[model samples]
Target: MLAESIVIIGVNHKTAPVAVREKLAFSGDCAGPLLTLMDIDGCRECCFLSTCNRVEVIFVASDPAVAAVAVRGFLFAKSGLGDAEAQQYSYLYQGKEAVAHLYNVAASLDSMVVGEPQILGQLKQAYRDAVEQKTTGVILNRLLHKSFSVAKRVRTETNIGGSAVSISYAAVQLAKKIFGSLQDKAVLLVGAGEMAELAAEHLVRQGIGRVIVANRTLERAAKLARKFNGTAVGLAELTTQLAEVDILVSSTGATDLILRKDEVKPLMRQRKNRPLFLIDIAVPRDLDPEINDLDNVYLYDIDDLKNVVDVNKAEREKEALRAEGIVAEEVVKFGLWLEGMELAPTITAIRQKANAIREVEVAKTLGIMKSLTENERRSVEMLANAIVNKLLHEPMIFLKNSTPHDNPQLKLAFIRQMFGLDKESPEQQPPRENV
Candidate 1:
């Protein structure tokens, strides 16, 4: 069974620390990784998904164990970690487990903040990239498409997403806690990417007094700022703007820290030692960890947002249980489809055997009745075919209706024996050409 070897191997926030996850996170397009995975010995079809909190490779492999080892090595190649260490930090799910895991991801039930909707879009983009690169085939195409539909079913049927709290939303909730009310607070967003946009959206909803977006690209920053009717500035003016804004959200893609403690210490004096709330949601961490040490300055990284998320998770957890049930139902449906696929060859073999027997009998009868009219001979052949179909129809239905409790291999073996399909003696069987 091709789907029996379907596997997902990677690290997420639950299994690996942010420091480790950041090392394996693929930044740009997925073309490079997809091609590399296809180059591996047993990898057949694959999709590469890298997000801020997790990096996963979902693939079908002819040799699962060997391919899994190679994939884990590839993922941790840039992390300077050996296979043992990488294996320690990573997780692997195979077969039906892999299908269920993907569905959970699509439904956001496995997210750092369960029910966050962003992961679904990210998964969809990864799938599209895999499709464009021709890295996905029939199995993955069906599996991934099913995952999307399952996610939609969960969203439509449950209120999981309705009460969802994202990392950005959690960050904003923390800011509101520290400042008491956002109505009088000015926020300085250090990056204008999706995370920053999410934070800004939540802040505006909280009725924050002002919003300031700062980015490496002024045009992009200005674009996002305009959406919120806020102000935009370049990265250089970060320290300058720190004096005016009470809350700062940094989610840039910088490889190094964009704001150091030394750079921010003097700014506190300029702001008259006012309390500053800094949220660093970037994976590599755009803000310095030491910045938290400064007087009247509070800093929270991505992991800190988890604590805030946990506070309001009870309702979402209940909704998540409902979503999990939906995922389980979809998983079983897909499993049945895969099992039916496994039955296809057996079904074909049975039909061929029945046709072969009918053909040999019809040929012998026609040979015996040489004086019969051509129309009469055709009628005899048609009658033989009709009898074969009628005899096999019930058996075909029984095969197709295989249940989870039924051992498919046993059922197939029984049918093969019952029909004498296992007999291969030349004297007992018609020649290939004659049949």
Candidate 2:
């Protein structure tokens, strides 16, 4: 049988909003059962990756067009989305395009915030989960490993991740501009949101002296606080915590201002003119814009962080061009391998056809000439084998080096036709033992 084509079906941050991506996301416990349900003859292998920004299902299938539809339907059932809703957000890619998309994703070029370092880890975990579930076979095993190498090459060969490109990372960069280093600073994380968590992670990595996590729900704050060895507080206690911290980062779902100028003015006075740095990463603006004018206080909103991200994005886009070239090269190389795989059996069939003919002809000749010496018979057999090998040499080399674009399947069909190899039963051309 021929090697399967790859198919990818899913929704990402670009194709769908967070609401849609969340609806499609699969947890580890759900992956095993889903893999079992998706198990079918057409799709030979599968892997699923789900993160905050994207949910993707990849497969190696006999017919990618059919498999793409099936996979999309499977995800739709899992998402509980109506026909109209599902159709609006789903995206699909087939064959080499699907493979290239996976390569780009592993390399982080497909991320909402390009060059973010988290997606690769997520991909690795997904690959492991699929492996553990036995959802992946040889083809995907090779492809996923190649993706890892491709990601490493993109990282080493390009500066795509050299600077801070994410909004949370940009917040960290802005903080460094004022404090030189965050080692001795106290950070008050004012929400347990993803952005706040990411910003807090950066702060911990920067060696912040203390971290205080506050949220409307103290339990949510406590959960995030445990991850970074930080203290948890309720939003009601924000006034007292604000006075103790040097930096405040807020990214919440609340529609109203979480911190206003009136709320912060007294905190600044208690600090004896000490500077306070504020970052509000929420949509609808968590911090009052009026607070930017306060004495000894600096406030940077989401828009300011995005401006920093814009600059970093421009630089990363330059690096992405180089990475694209690398992906294209790898895609062609993998395509050639898949093509060469399909043509290999035909090469074996022809060689077996030639060898069988030689064996019959040689035996008949030796049997009729009974007086011939054993040494003469040996010479004849050797000459027959040499001739068969010489005749097959060029064709074997050509098949091994050929690609899918060479119309390899057509070439194989023609080879079988020309040599009358089609008359032989598949049992006659059963795989020859490797020498």
Candidate 3:
């Protein structure tokens, strides 16, 4: 039988703040556990996407309502948010709507700053994480691969991602605004993750001198340090290196602040207040919120970067109408496919039921007319087959054209029960029409 399958739940910048988002963020280490949790009962396939701006759980389930509720409860419990808070901010989508949402997200249409390119990479990482954990099955694999293709199509065919509107790029721009030139600035990258790498690359492109990468894992830190030809140090010594660094960009996954106000206060004294610029891109935030109060320490959190992102967002919104039109076109095409899937089994059963009845009637007539010529029996059989095909032609066409709005599945089920085709028949035949 054809089954209803699709993504059920998601949460992003639109639904939650960075603090709330970070609490639900799934790390590489947590992928296995999260996948295990999603595999319980109703969930069929799963992928967890975690980035600075979003923490979404994508799944294909037999029951979307049950799956959505379970996912929402899990997120709220893990994030320590009240049920009311989750209900207030969280959004739920099912079936074709959910698929459309994911396509836009992967295509960067729903990004905080539309057409920002980093989201595609973040989605790729999420897919990889799911694959590594062995949680994503056939449905999720196909969905993600198709989503990637759709994103590529939108980027290549349209002017959406043609410009850079990402916060990382904006951070670089903001840095330039503060300091006339970045040529002699020292940049400290406090995490070896993708975000830090992106910001560090952007800073280096602007001729920044001496990049440093610090992380809890020395090997990972060294790998990134080597890529930029910079120094790598244990995160424990981050406070000591703070004084010498001119620009600090921290995106560690640590649950607490790496650079508290007290820690940065002494560093300010040592640098003689050399105007340290700190960008806290992490969810829980690598730098303390209180650090903004310290003299000479300028701190910019995820929200602080919004002003820069908003300027880009406004420009992109003009092109968004065009992009949204593209998404709508694609969504309708997908919806048709989903509708066709619903009719598939019913159509198969109908053909089977008709063919079985025709065969039985043909055999009974042949047995009763054993004295008739062979040509006569052959003609009767052919006539019966033609009659069955003619009788089913219109219903088959109707099934193919039906939409979800018409409750295609319920209609198909009713047809199956009415024709006594709900149960399998020994003389079943394959569906003649290709879906």
Top of the candidates by TM-score = 2
Clashes of each: 0, 0, 0
Model 3 stretches with alpha carbons more than 4 Å out: 1-5, 166-200, 203-315, 343-435
Query: Which whole-number lDDT from 0 to 100 does residue 269 have in model 2?
Result: 86
In model 3, residue pairs whose N, Cα or C atoms come closer than 3 Å (at least 3 residues apart or on different chains), thus clashing, are: none
Lowest lDDT sum, 10 consecutive residues, model 1, at 426-435
* RMSD to native, candidate 2: 13.0
- Put down candidate 2 lDDT per residue, 268-309, tens digits, no spaces: 889897788999888988899999999978999988888888
Candidate closer to the true structure by TM-score (higher is better), 1 or 3 = 1
Error of 3 at 332 (Å): 1.7
lDDT of 1: 0.87
TM-score of candidate 3 to 2 decimals: 0.50
TM-scores, all candidates, are: 0.55, 0.58, 0.50
lDDT of model 2 at residue 131? 88
Candidates ranked, most accurate by TM-score first: 2, 1, 3
lDDT value for model 2: 0.81
- For candidate 3, lDDT tens digit of each residue in 151-211? 8767766777654477888888878878869988899899888989999999999989899
